[model samples]
Structure formats: C-alpha cells, structure tokens
Target: MVDDLALARHLADLADAITASRFRSRDLAVDRKPDRTPVTDADLAVEDAVRAALAEHRPGDEIAGEERGGQVGAGRTWVLDPIDGTKNFLRGVPAWATLLALVEDGSPVVGMISAPALGRRWEAASGRGAQAGPPGSPEPISVSGVGELADAYVSTTHLGTWVEHHSRESYLRLVDACWENRAFGDFWQHCLVAEGAIDLAAEPIVNPWDVAAVQVIVQEAGGTFTDLSGERTFQGGSALSSNTRLHDGALALLRR
Candidate 1:
C-alpha cells in the first residue's frame, strides 16, 4: 500500500499534469460557481482525476474537494483544492497551484502543494517536517526566527477579503506593524511562511480545502497555523500562518 504522504504527492503530480497543460490556454473553459467564483475545466478535471485515484488506492477514505464536495468527517479524508489560484490562472499568471491534504479525523497529517509553473512544490508529513523547491532534490524548509513584528515580513491573500470576511482595519494593523507586506494571495503566501521567506500570512476567509494543506505544511515547518481568532483549526473559515514566535503578536494586531 502506498504511504499517505506518498499518495498525497502522487495526487499532486496528477494535478500538476492537468493544471500545467491548461494554465494559459486560450480555450480553457471557465464558469462561475453559485458564489460567483470562477471555476475552470482544469479545476474539475484535476479534482475528478484525484478522486478517482483515491477511490482506487484508498477507497475507504472520504474525499472533500473544492469542486466536487464532501465532508471531512471522522477518520481519514483526502482534501483537495484543484486550483487554488484560479483567478491567477485565468489571468495567465504563474502563481496558481494544486493543493492536497490528508486530514485524518479532522486534523491534517500530510500536505502536498504543486505549483508546476513556478517550478516548485512543497510537502510535509506530521513527523517528517517540510520540504520545498525542485522536484527531485528538495531540501528541508522551516519558518524564520524573526520574533518581532517590526522586523517581520507579512502577506495576505487579498485586501478586499478582509473587508468582506473580517475587519480591514484589523489587517491593516498587522501590515502597519510588520516591516514589509505584500498581497501574496492564495496558497503561495502561506507556503512562503513555511519556507521562512515570509514571517506571516493572513487570510480573512477560506474554505476547508483552501487551508487543510496549508495548516499541515506551516506547522511541520515549525511555524504556527491558526484562524484569526487564534484557534488552530483549518475549519475556522479564516487563517493565519506565522513563524512560531511572532504568531501571538500578529494575532493581537489582527484582533477584531
């Protein structure tokens, strides 16, 4: 039987093949979901392909995906966000990626994120730690040691999301407290926190599939992952990833 992290990596590879091919294609099919979010043929294609593989390899496991949805119930569930930055893909930007996480009994134990266009991927298991970069020679990765917000670099998915889901003023407070900040939207920003490139990443709103993998990678990198309210669960509908030392300070500034 394939190991859980290995299966997650295989799913990422399967997703990368589909996303990389259709990424900037002029004929890619794009549709709007009920929430007015864009969904591409690539998104559906990747999730369906992944579900098929999970069915064959881990049939008893539950599956939850952005496109074809299921619940992350008791026991093991494979969580997927086929294309985490669909808007970027639509705009021909190379920041898009496929995110996969293995949530066992509601907690993420393994994560695999593949951004083939960026020529990078990140993976982490509960006890294995985090690694990212080239396909074959990836090295260990961890969060920065920056302890103070004044010396830290921060990132967020979108400024508009803060206004809609949380307090924009709260986010601005964090940006103002940090040394530098960027709108490094989506999965990439959180991965940046995991790699020590950035100290914190905050998102005002997110779904389970959006952050299950992020939660795993960030924690494995020796950072902290939590909702804005400071609870460490991916289901919080919001997220904050930070180097361990700076999390509480970042959270204090983002309090509603």
Candidate 2:
C-alpha cells in the first residue's frame, strides 16, 4: 500500500510553494464564482499544481478540487481546496491554508493541511495519530478535555452568513452557551479544535472540499466531526467539529 499520508503531505508542500509565493502579490488576480465567493489566481494555481503532481505521482487516482471538479472514484479520490480561506489570503490576513485529503473507499484515510503564511501544518493518517507544529518539526496533537458546553470555547466563520443560512438562532444559542466565542473562521478554527487549543469549531455552510480533510484530522485527534443533525459526512452542507465531550450538547442546541 502507498504511504497515503506522506503523499498527502507532499501535495501540501507543493501547494504551499505556489500559495506562499503569490500570497500578497501586487498583481494577484481575483474572480468570483457563481456563488459570489472570491477565487484568486493563487487558488487556481495551487490547485493546478496539486492536480499536476497527482497526475504524475498517482495518475490512476481520481481528483476533485475547488477550481475544477471531478468525480470521486471507488478506489482513491484526492480532494483539494487549494485555498481554504481565500478571503483572508486576498486581504493578506495570513489565515489561509491548502487542504488535501486522500479518500479511500469514500472515507478520508489521509489528510494534510498546510498554512505556510502561519508557519504551521497538520497531518494525520488513519491509524497514525494526528500531529501539528511548525512546517518542519511536528508534535502529536489531540482534542481538549472540556466536557461541558458552558466551559467550551466555540468558533465560527461569519455570523451574518450563519443567519442568512437560517441557522442564526441556533448559532447564537451555541455562542451564548459557550464560555467564549470568536469568529476564527475556516480551516483554522477546526484545526484549532484538533490541536486542543479550542473546544468547538463550526460553520453554518460548507462544501465537501472545505471539510473533507478537516474531518479526518479532527477525528484522528480524538474529536467528533458531524453536521448539525449529527451525521458524520462532509456532504451535509454544514460542519460541527468538537472535542467528543461537547459534540452532542452542541449538536442538540444547533438542531433546536
């Protein structure tokens, strides 16, 4: 069997090279998708680089990316979100990252997230524990032990978007229930939860590319990742990642 986790991390390295180079370029080009979300040249370039690498390294494997879509195959499908926080990258906020996940038999068995701007990267393989640290030296990571919602630290992307998605009431309830809340947004929040720095990270809306890699990382880090309805699939259009202790209570409030 191929070392899928190593391959995933290699892809992340390739993506970081492209993204870090153009991160704040004066001439970086930007466009808007039909959904009105922003996409930048860096995003397209990063995805193209990752796809090309996969084509050469694992040509038979299927691939799916945010910029260009492809079907998930039965054997292996590489999922890519070249830039998970495009808005942050566009604004030079240093909050963006490249996300790559290798899905085997419809489940992500290897996952890697590289945030060059933040000088951080995280990776996990099914059976191997999750890890995070500076790009070079990584240490094992796990979820926090916060057992109650009242003591948990919660995070989300945007309150306005959450409200617009018809989840405002429940989201507000979650925020109110938590001891602290921040709009830490995107992959960073979920990664934080995986690192035990936070207790929960959720979004009222998300795509498969947005959460596939993150789901594996969190799960491998001793947390639970699910939709508001408690289903553990990335296609649910929303995400709720938490240290296992707080997942049910948080999901219950979100469902209300």
Candidate 3:
C-alpha cells in the first residue's frame, strides 16, 4: 500500500506549483468560447507530474485523472482531478484545487485536496484522520457539533442546475430551514464541512473527480457522505455530506 502521507503531500506540491504559477496570469487568457486549453494544459501537466512521481515511487499502482482518462496498473488506483473547479479557474476565482485519492478496488482510502490560491490543503488516509491548513501549518479539523437541522448551515453549489432539474422547491425549502446559505461553488464548500465551518453541502450534480477527494476528507473528519438518497457510493451523480447528526434531516429535505 502506498500509504505514506508525505508522498501525498509531495504530489499535492507538484500540483500546486503548476496551478499557482498560471492561476491568474494575464498571458493565460480566457476566451468567450470557454477556452479550455489553459486549464487543460494545467490538468495534463499536473497529472503527468503525478504519474511520473508515482512511477518512481509506487511503481505497481494504477492511475486515473480527469485530463487523460484512466491507466490501470495494480489493484490500487490513484484518482486525480488536476483542477476540480475549472470554471472558477477560468473566471480568475481561486476556488479550484488539485484532488488526489487512492482507491483500492472501488473505494478511496486516502485523499488529498490542495487549493494553493486559497492557501489551504486537506489530507486524509483511512483511519489516520484528516488534516488541513496552509502547507506545513496543519490543524486538526472535524465536522460541526450542531446536531439539529434548524440550527444548521447549508451550502448549495450550482443553484441554477437544482432549479432546472425541478429540485428547486425542495432546495428552497432547505434554505428556509437553514441558519444561513452560501452559493460558494466547488470543492471549497466540502472542505468547509470537513473543517467544521459548515454543516451540510447539497451538491445536486457533480462527477467523480469533483467529489472523490472531498469524500475521503469528510469521512475522515467524522462526517457522512452519500447520495441525496443516502447511499454511500458516489455513483448517484449527487451527494449530501454533513455531520452524522444532521445527515438524515438534510437527506430528507433534499429528497423532498
């Protein structure tokens, strides 16, 4: 098992160097057609760097990334999202991150989420707990203690999509019940849950790369992760993550 957290940190470092350097560079211009070249370049570069490092260190492991598809090696596969919030990156918003996770068979055991622009990184391995903060400045964080649904805070990313999918009424009902709400899209909201800064995150639509790393971080931080229907797997295309106390309540609201 490539269980070393240091290696995870190193991989995150490789991703950060590539992303931070080009984050808001005027030369890295954005076009109206959603020129994906810049973020695509960053993605491939970061993934390639990670693959190279893994080749040298964890030679027997497989690797998968958003930019280049999947490469099956050993039973263990490293899942990566070179930039989870590509739209945010294109918009000069610092909400993007590099997400890495080690999945054995079909489950993620270790996850690392690095957002250099936000000056934060979160890392977790099965049974090791989750850690987050600026590089080299780690803090032990966990989910919030608010067990009641009415006192909870909620974050919903991609509001328009929820309404488009006819889940708007239920979502609005959820908002009315929450103490506060944030449309802060992308991985940051999930990290907020991991840091005990937020109660629940209702993500109506996302891909594996979007939630893989966050899944491990939240679970390791003592929170629950599941589809809106409450299944543990991420295959349902949406997820509801929160402290265990309010998960069912949040799930009930989302399902309605």
Candidate 4:
C-alpha cells in the first residue's frame, strides 16, 4: 500500500513535468472559452506517461484516466486525472493539479495530488495519515478544529451548477453560514481543507478523478468527505469536505 502511494506520488511528479512545462506556453488566443487543443494534448501526454509507468511497475494493475478512459489489469486499479482543473490551466491559472489514486477492489487506498504551479503536493495511504507540503519539504498535516459553523471558513470552485441543480437560495444559505467563503476551486480548495487552512469545501459537481485523491488526503488529515447529503462515495459527483467538526452543520445548511 505504501509502495502504491509512493508510485502514485512519483507518477504525479512525472505528470507535473509534462504539465508545468507546458502550462503557460499556449498562445492566449481565446477563440471560444479557450482552445481545448493544448490542454487536450497535455492531458493525453500525462495519461500516457502514467499508463506507461503503471505498466512498468504495477504491470498487473488496471488503469483509468480522465483523458484515455480505462484499461483493466489486476485486482488493484489506478484512477487518474491528468489535469483536474483544465479550464484553470488553459487560463494561465494555478488551480489545476495531477490527481492519482490506487483503488484496491473498489476504494482508493493510496492517493496523491500534485499542483506544481502552486508548489504543493499531498500524498497518503489508507492507514498512513495524510501529508502535504511544498515540492520538497513534506510534513504531517491535519484539519482545523473549527467546531462552530458560523466561525468556519468555507469554499468551492464553482457556483453555476450548485445554483442550477440545487437552489441559489440554498447556496446562499451555505455561504451565509460560513464566516468566509472562497471560490478557490479545484484541488487547492480540498488541499486547504487537508491543511486545516479552511474548515469546509463544497463543490456542486465533480467526479472520481476530481475528488478521489482529495478524498484520501482529507480523510487522512482528520477531516471528513461526503456528498452534499453527507454520503461517503466519489460516485456522488459532488462533495462537502470539512474538518469533521463542522461537516454536519454545513450539511444541514445545504440540505435545508
């Protein structure tokens, strides 16, 4: 399991190399919500590199990536997001990341998130507790002890879907409940939860690749992860991560 975590982190490094080198290299020609070609190329390239690394080390393990889809192999599988925040990447923003996870049976046992542009990386195994830091200096980290909802700082990447699927009024209720709210979307918001910098992060829409690595990091950091309804599964497609203390309170406001 520890080996899987290490491999995932190493693969994240490989992904960072491919992505960081190409982040701002694209021409800023916003023809229509940013050209997809550059990010698509980078995505495929990173997925390919990860697949190749998996093939070499965990030869029998299956692979699933956002860009390349899936290829079954051994009992243990890896789910990857070559780039989690593609829009941000294409926009010359640093909110993107390389998300990697080892799913044993059906759950992620080892997860890693690398955002080279932000100079941050977080990695964890099922039992090993989470760790986060700059590119080099790793350290143990955990969620904050903010127990009151009114005093909690909260964030999310987007509000369109939340306002669309749920009610804008409900979304506003959540914002009103927190002391602070930020739209610091993508892996960074979740990382902030893991580092205890924020009390909660709620996203209206996401995917396994979007939240898998983050889920592991949050849980291992003494926090909790769940759908807006508080169900613990990436399949929910939306998440509400918190420092555990304020999770249910946030859930209550959202559910109301």
Candidate 5:
C-alpha cells in the first residue's frame, strides 16, 4: 500500500506552487460554474497539476475535482478542491486554500489543506495525529477544550446561505448562544477549529470537496466533525465541526 498521507501532502505542495504564483495576478482569468460560484485560472491550473501528479504516482486511483469532474471508483478515490475560498482569493484576502483528500470505500483516510498565502498547511491520516505549519517545523494540533456554548467562539462561512437553505433560524440561535462569532468562512474556519483557535465551525451547505480534507483533520485533532444533523460524513451537504465537548450541544441547537 502507498503512504497515502505522504502522497496527500505532496499533492498539496504541488497545488500550493500553482496557486501562489497566480494569487493576485492581474491577468488571471475568471469564469462561473453553473452554481454561480466563481472559478479562476488558478483553480483550474492547480487541479490540473494535482491530477497530473496523481496519474503519474497512482494511476489506478480514481479522481474527483471541483473544477473538472471525474469518477469516484469503488476503490481509492482522490478528491480535490483547487481553491476552497476563490472569492477571498480573488478579493486579495488570504483565507483561501487548496484541499485534497484520499477516500477509501466512501470514507476519507488521508487529508491535506495548503494555504500558501497564509503560510500554513495542515494534514492528517486516519490513525496518525493531525499537524499544521510549514513542512520544516510542523506541530501537532488539537481542538479547544471549551465545554459550553456560552464560553465558546464560533464561526461560519456565510449567514445568507443558511437563510437560503432554510437553516437561518437554527444557525442564528446557535450563534446567539455562543460567546462570540465571526464569518471566518471556508476551509480556514474548520482548520481553526482543529488548531484550537476556535471552538466550532459550521456551514449550511457544502460540497464534499469543501469538507473532506478538513473532516479527517478535525477528527484526528480530537474534535468531532458532523453535519448539522449530527451524522459524521462530509456528504451530508453541510458541516458542524467542534471540540468534542461542544459538538452535541451545537448539533442539538442547529437541529432544533
């Protein structure tokens, strides 16, 4: 068997190189997907680079990417989101990241998120512990110990999506109960939860590519990652990641 985690990290490195080069390039091209979300040349380039590397290294593995779709085979499947925060990246914000994951039989076994603009990267395998920082001096990371919602710091990508998806009331109630809340948005919010910088991070709707990498990272970092309904799967269409201590409470509030 291959060292899946190592391969994931290597893929992240490959993606980071492409994304960093085009971060704010004035000539960068932009397009819109059918869902109305933005897609940039950087996104397409990053995915293409990773896909090419994977083909050379693990040709048998299936591949699925946000910009360019591929099959999810019965065996190992690699998922890629070239840029998780394209809006932020286009706006010159430093919160975007390239997310990658290896899924085996429907569950993620290895994951990685690389944010070169922010100078950070995080990765995890099913059994190995989660880690963050530069490749040279990585550090093990874990979730916060916040046990109560009233004492917790929370984050979400956007409230408008929640409202549009019929989750606004539940989301607001949870935020009202928290000590503080921010629109940290995208992959950064969940990475923060894994790093113990925040207690919880939720999203009303998300594609598998958006949460697959972060799911394993959060779980390996001693946190609980679930959909708003409390099921622990990235395909749930939404996410609610928190320190294990606060997960149930947050889930209950969001489901009520």
Candidate 6:
C-alpha cells in the first residue's frame, strides 16, 4: 500500500520536470477543447510521462487523466490531472499543480499534489497523516482550530463559477459568514485548508479529478470534504473542504 504512495511521488517528480521546464517557455503551445478551456503542451506532456511511468511501475493499475479521459471504475484507478490549474499554468500564475490520486473501490486511498512552482508538495495516504513541502524534508500538517464561521477564513475558485454552475448567492453566504476570503483557486486552496492556513475552501463546480486528491489530503489532515449536498464523495460534482469542526456550518451557509 505504501509502495503505491511512493509510485505516486515518483510520478509527481516526473510531471514536475516537464511542467517546470515549460511553465513560462516562450514557445509553449496552447489549444482549446470544445468546452473552451485551455490545454497547454505541458499538460499533455506531463500526463503522457506519468502514464508511461505507471505502465512500467504498476502495470496492472488503470489510469484516468484529464487529457486522456479514462474512467475510474470498480478497481484501482490512478487519477491524474496533469495540471490542475491549466489557466494558471498558461498565464504563469504560479498556482498550478500536478494532481494524482489512487482510487480503490471508488475512494482515494493515496493522494499526491505537486506544485513545483510554489516549491511545495502535499501528500497523504488513507491511514497516514498529511504532509507538505519537498520530498527531501517533509512536515506533517493539519487543519486550523477555528470552529466558528465568523472567525474563519474561506476561499473559492471563482465567483463566476458559482453563477454558472450552482449559486453565487449561496457561495456569498459562505464568504459573508467568514472573517476573510480569497479566490485562491484550484488545488492550492484545498491544500491551504489541509495545512491550517485557512478554515474553509468551497467550490460550486468541480470534476472528480479536481478534488479526488483534495478529499484525501483534507480528510487525513483532520478536515472534511463533501459536495454542497453534503455527500462525502469526490464524484459529487461540487466540493467544500473545511476544518472538520466547521464543515456542517459551512455547508448550511452554502445551501442557504
């Protein structure tokens, strides 16, 4: 089981090499899918590299990547979002990351998030606590002690997403209830919740790849992850990460 975590780390390292090199390249290639989201050359390259490494290291494991589009079914599936913040990557925002999660029986047991540009990598296994920083030296992390929404800090990807997918009014109720808030979009906000930098990270729209690894890290770090409907599954179509003490309250506000 631990070996699977090691393989995920190795895969993150492989992705780092490709993403770091191409992050700000003058000649980086960008394309658009039917959804109008940007896909950079680095995104495709990192997924391809990680897929190859997994083929050699864990031949029997299945892979589902943002670029390649495979399914996570009733077995061990390696989920990959080669670049969790592709728009950030393309625009050189420094908040993008390579997200990998090992899902078994529909739940992620091992999660690894590598944001090389920020020089931090956060990871967690099902029974192990979460950790962050470089692989050379890691430190265990957990959620904040804030128990009340009025004293908490919160975040989300974008206000526009709430309007488009769920309800911006509902998301605003969450923010207005908090002490402070930021847009801190993508994987970083959830990681912040895990490491206690913030108290809540909510998103009205997300794919499983967007939050699968996030679910594990936050949960292992003494937090909670669920959709607006309050279901604890990553495939719930939306997500909210919070210090466990504040999860229910946060959910109540978001559903307002």
**Which regions of candidate 1 fall more than 4 Å away from where they truly are?**
none
lDDT of 6 by residue, 71-145 (tens): 999989999999999998999889999999999989999999999999999999999999999865779999999
TM-score of each: 0.98, 0.97, 0.91, 0.91, 0.97, 0.98
Clashing pairs in 6: none
The candidate, 4 or 5, that scores higher on lDDT is 5
Cα shift from native, residue 175, model 4 (Å): 0.7
- Could you give candidate 4's per-residue lDDT for residues 46-94 as a string of tens digits? 9999999888998878888876778434478888989888888877888
Give the 10-residue window scoring lowest on summed lDDT in candidate 6. Answer: 1-10
lDDT of 3 at 179: 91
RMSD each, Å = 0.8, 1.1, 2.6, 2.9, 1.2, 1.1
lDDT of 1 by residue, 133-235 (tens): 9776679999999988999999986778889899989988999999999988899999999999999999999999999999999999999999999999999
In model 3, the Cα lDDT at residue 54 comes to 91
Ten-residue region with minimum lDDT total, candidate 4? 28-37
Steric collisions counted per model? 0, 0, 0, 2, 0, 0
**Can you list the residue pairs that collide in candidate 3?**
none
CA lDDT for candidate 1: 0.93
- lDDT string for model 3 (1-256, tens) is 5455788899999889999998877776433324343454676678899989999999878888777778434478888888888778867888889998887767778889999999999989889899999998988889999988889989997678797753988898888889999887778888899999999988888777778778889999999999877888655688778988999888777875
